[model samples]
Target chain A: MIILGVDPGLTRCGVGVIEAGAYRRLSFIHVDVVRSDPKSPQDRRLLTIYDGLAAKLDEFAPDVVSIERVFAQENRNTVLGTAQAAGMAMLAAAQRNIPVALHTPTESKMAITGNGKAEKIQMERMVARILNLNTLPKPADAADALAIAICHALRPAGAIQGGEREEHLTAAQRQWAKAAQKASRGRTQGRAM
Target chain B: MIILGVDPGLTRCGVGVIEAGAYRRLSFIHVDVVRSDPKSPQDRRLLTIYDGLAAKLDEFAPDVVSIERVFAQENRNTVLGTAQAAGMAMLAAAQRNIPVALHTPTESKMAITGNGKAEKIQMERMVARILNLNTLPKPADAADALAIAICHALRPAGAIQGGEREEHLTAAQRQWAKAAQKASRGRTQGRAM
Candidate 1:
């Protein structure tokens, strides 16, 4: 399965595409950052993000799209922009009938580095290692996008299995698990991205 | 000039169209609400909003689009959805090269009732009176939307002219003026919605 991952942002949106090979092997297809002029109108910037991602979807044609989910606790000034960018990405994916998965930042870190609280550098290093890349992905946003895709690529087979394991998790871990479950519920229920 | 005004929301988005005739006479063209099922996935809901608004823009072909400018202080749970919906409205307008204008709640209230703190019923009554509608617009959202369009229609010719009048304003009024000016700046500067 090919996955398109989006690190949604207003000024700079990161997009990464990866193909899952036999035995869970992954190969990179494309990675890039779509930048919008901060000087542009908010709606125009959003349109730039939307048009950029729509073009990428057309070019890459990934089977599924994964994006970071926005939470209220994020930086207030940028949260709305990020959410709008994510909304654009989801809209692009939905327009094409591609399934969308939302992964939280902690879930992405855990997927890449086996620790929900892994530092950015560690997460980047692990993404490089997992993808067998000699060099790290340029721009932290791009690496972050790749990490989101990897999380979806390595997601557990079923929520039932994940739920069964949740009983053993700590409170914080359980919270993350529940949030992830709520996000992933969209995959099955055809609910909001 | 024609204006399309949107009261952006996730569950129910209000849309109104009005024509600004010579001598500033206003006539209502259309008003209604676009709703999305809460049970639908986030992406699906956004698409429903985008598609609905896109269709309106196509049919109305308004000269400009006006929408409520989102503030960070709004209800936390619904703010992101509202922002995303507003972004969709802006995108629809931008796609058609329609000039987009944003008005705050205070601005809309003030424009309709000559008082920034006017109650909903007051704003609705003024909207009905301004449009010469015998019956009040059903659904408060639609009336709110008509107020936004009317605000745009009656807006001063330029910010510089409004700024000249700011010396006579109260502290709270000056603050709202500044916010409105900043938002209007984005329209000309091509800044984010």
Candidate 2:
């Protein structure tokens, strides 16, 4: 299966493509989507991200697309940017009816580093080690996109092959996660105050 | 001075621009950079983001660009994507000789809502309140980009004016943050295990 991994951002996005099934053959496809002067006007910036992402989809077609799911609430600006990036990515995939898989940051990190909280240097080292590359991917973002692809490669076939794996988290699991998140938010607020 | 706030991502980047120091005129911009494959080949995807961002810059011509500083460590993949987006944005601004300011998530949140851990709804409400807008900006990211712009407007003139801001973070601060992060990682690892 050919899995496409995307590290979505409002300005610059990292994209990596990997073909796995037998031997894993991974390739670096693209990295960085830099938007300028977000201060100008809203419609124009949205149009820029939409058009740019569409062009990428047209250029590289894959069986499945994998993206990092964002769950951050601390930085309102960053969270919103990430959510928009995620939304735009989903929209692009939805437009083509392509199945998209969202992976938590932990999932990708654990899959690559065997440690959920592995530092960037460690992750990059692992990527280089697993891929047998002579050097690390420059600009850590590229390494991360590659790591997400690796995570998809390591998952069981059933978890990712048929597009059956892309369903939302189980209702109970979602509820639990949400509750935990709410609790966490309360704690953070208490601490801040 | 015109300050532009950008929420960058691979898909859609939310941008809001406002004129500061006078009547405080506000303008919003949203740019979309959608890639078909989040995991497209790196060169292709990078080009897409670069071109899209370049086009937006040409259109906006912002004097100062303010972006959210990423502090996400739990989601390695998300952080990587955000870093890439931020990198692209910085590079674009550098090319234009425009001053760039990076704000931590907390700073932006506090600036907007008077609360560092404010909820998304709270942030949206505050953005509307501060901007005196009838409603919140759509897609959350748009509101955030606008918030970044507003944050810049609120900063002391010496902090963000005259191309005085450095393009990157100081090494000492980065090391300190990373060291603290590493220590936190050990704690989280112990708990997870």
Against the true structure, what is each candidate's TM-score?
0.88, 0.43
For model 1, residues A33-100, the per-residue Cα lDDT tens digits are 99999888777888899999999999999999999887654535677788889999988999999988
Docking quality tier of candidate 1?
acceptable
The parts of candidate 1 lying over 4 Å away from their true place are: A160-193, B160-193
Q: Which candidate number maximizes lDDT?
A: 1
Q: Which candidate is the best by TM-score?
A: 1
Candidate 2 chain A: 10-residue stretch with minimal lDDT: A184-193
DockQ per candidate, 2 decimals: 0.41, 0.04
Among these predicted structures, which one has the highest DockQ? 1
lDDT against the true structure, per candidate, is 0.81, 0.59
**lDDT tens string, model 1, B25-68?**
99988999999998888889899999999999999999989998
Candidate 1 chain A: minimum summed lDDT over ten consecutive residues — where?
A184-193
Per-residue alpha-carbon lDDT of model 2 for B1-193, expressed as tens digits? 7777877655556667676656555444443332324555323344466556656677778888887655444444345355445555655666677777766555566556656577978888887776667777666667777777786666433333423333353543333344334433543342110
